[model samples]
Target: MSTQTGRCYCGAFHVGTKASPQTVAYCHCSDCRRLSGAPVAAFAAFDPAHVVITPRWPDAKSHAKGVKRWFCPECGTQLGATYDYLPDQVYMPVGLFDQADRWQPQLHSHADSALPWLHIDDGLPRNAASSRASLTMASCDS
Candidate 1:
């Protein structure tokens, strides 16, 4: 029954959630890197029913099949995303959360795609590809 809130870079968009995240993890896929403009991107997956976006969620854009992303119209900050495969959860960038420090990633997804220069020896589980099975199980647990 914890609540987390955050706003977009330009303060044009806001988000809040009443429940804890189902999972938190790092994504090293090229798609995520380009979208986040970072070597790696971390996300916290939440049940859509527990999350609220002020004003409204922007229209989603799908550059890749099965993946739809939303961005703030004012500053273009990546807002959130949903995957057709993971219909029940929405993935929001960890950096966008006011309590980002509290949501450390539990695993590395698409580890094989991770940049060679990036060395994170946090001893977290590394999945060579999408950790959909693990992610799905985590949601079920919640």
Candidate 2:
């Protein structure tokens, strides 16, 4: 019920959401780790309508097709990503939150791609791909 506010590392971009996240996960996908420069990227997903994003720079880029990743022009801080595969949702890096401790990752996505040296013993569900990935094909049929 509480709102969450966040900004890019250099404060060039800002985002706020009043609605509860639709889902949260620690993603180990190669793209995520490469973009985040971390072993895992923890993010909270929300309906795009629920989030308000203000970007100081007009253009943000993504290497992946069908996905747009935004960053701060000033600091190049990776703010979030939106997938064309999931039009209803936006993924925000949990670390950007003003109070990141308040959020907990609900599961691990792309677990099969996780780094061999990095171990996660949090006991959450681990999916080879997003739990929602399987629903993608069916969703486009309607």
Candidate 3:
């Protein structure tokens, strides 16, 4: 019953999903931090089956065991994110929606690797490390 829409930076990759999401989490792992080029990366989960993707956007280079990324080939915009391991839903870059504040982060992952200078006092759960261990601690109550 839940439905949402998102698009890539160049609007080449458009997505329509019909799942609200079990929870949304932030990743502070080295890969995430480096890929996002930020202190952390934010992602919202959706059922992969409920997502409809428009393959007009350029393909992305993937790493990790079960994840793939989509971006604008011409602009190199970090347009979208997805996970194959879970296989039920998809994850979209909250940035692409311009509704970053609408969905609050459930936790801060990889607190163990967080930059010493960065302060994480968002009042959300803080995971000392980046592992399913941290994610288990972040089980969304909602």
Candidate 4:
């Protein structure tokens, strides 16, 4: 199994995964954009059992129903998230991974919410809403 490691912006939180991600995706939802402070947010989904966060994982914050997000207490960097619908997986920002270059997004979620000014002409599939089926299927396949 391939292992990946990364740290928060302030280096106060470290994350390690013993296995490769189940899937990687780009989310254009406003909530994700606001949380990441980016036009689009990319995340790598993995089985929570395979991941470990050192120095402790701070309590999660839930501003939206069914979604819980974790951040670094020291730097406020978004660490990871878990959704009630996708309870089997945890999503971590791809930018937080040291091997981010290897984890290219496979699809775009909430494409309808994408900002007009941001144009990613990648031919990847674009889901008008949450790609729950695709995402869950990927985890099953993994």
The count of backbone overlaps in candidate 3 is 7
Q: Which one wins on lDDT?
A: 4
Q: How would you encode candidate 3's per-residue C-alpha lDDT over 18-126 as one tens digit per residue? A: 7665567776667767767787777776655776767654566676455667667755666556555445545565665544577787877666777888776789877
Q: What is the lDDT of candidate 1?
A: 0.84
Clashing pairs in 4: none
- The local distance difference test score of each candidate is 0.84, 0.74, 0.63, 0.85
Error of 3 at 96 (Å): 1.7
- Select the stronger candidate by TM-score from 2 and 3: 2
Q: Comparing candidate 3 with candidate 4, which one achieves the higher lDDT?
A: 4
- Find the 10 residues in a row with the least total lDDT in model 3: 133-142
Cα lDDT, model 2, residue 135 = 30
Taking all chains together, the TM-score of candidate 1 against the true structure is: 0.93
The RMSD of every model to the true structure, in order and in angstroms, is: 3.8, 4.1, 4.7, 3.7
Number of backbone-clashing residue pairs for each candidate, in the order shown: 0, 0, 7, 0
Over 4 Å off, model 2: 55-57, 133-142
Tens digits of lDDT, candidate 1, 35-84? 88899999899999998998999898877777788899899998888877
User: After superposition, which runs of candidate 1 have C-alpha atoms over 4 Å from their true positions?
Assistant: 137-142
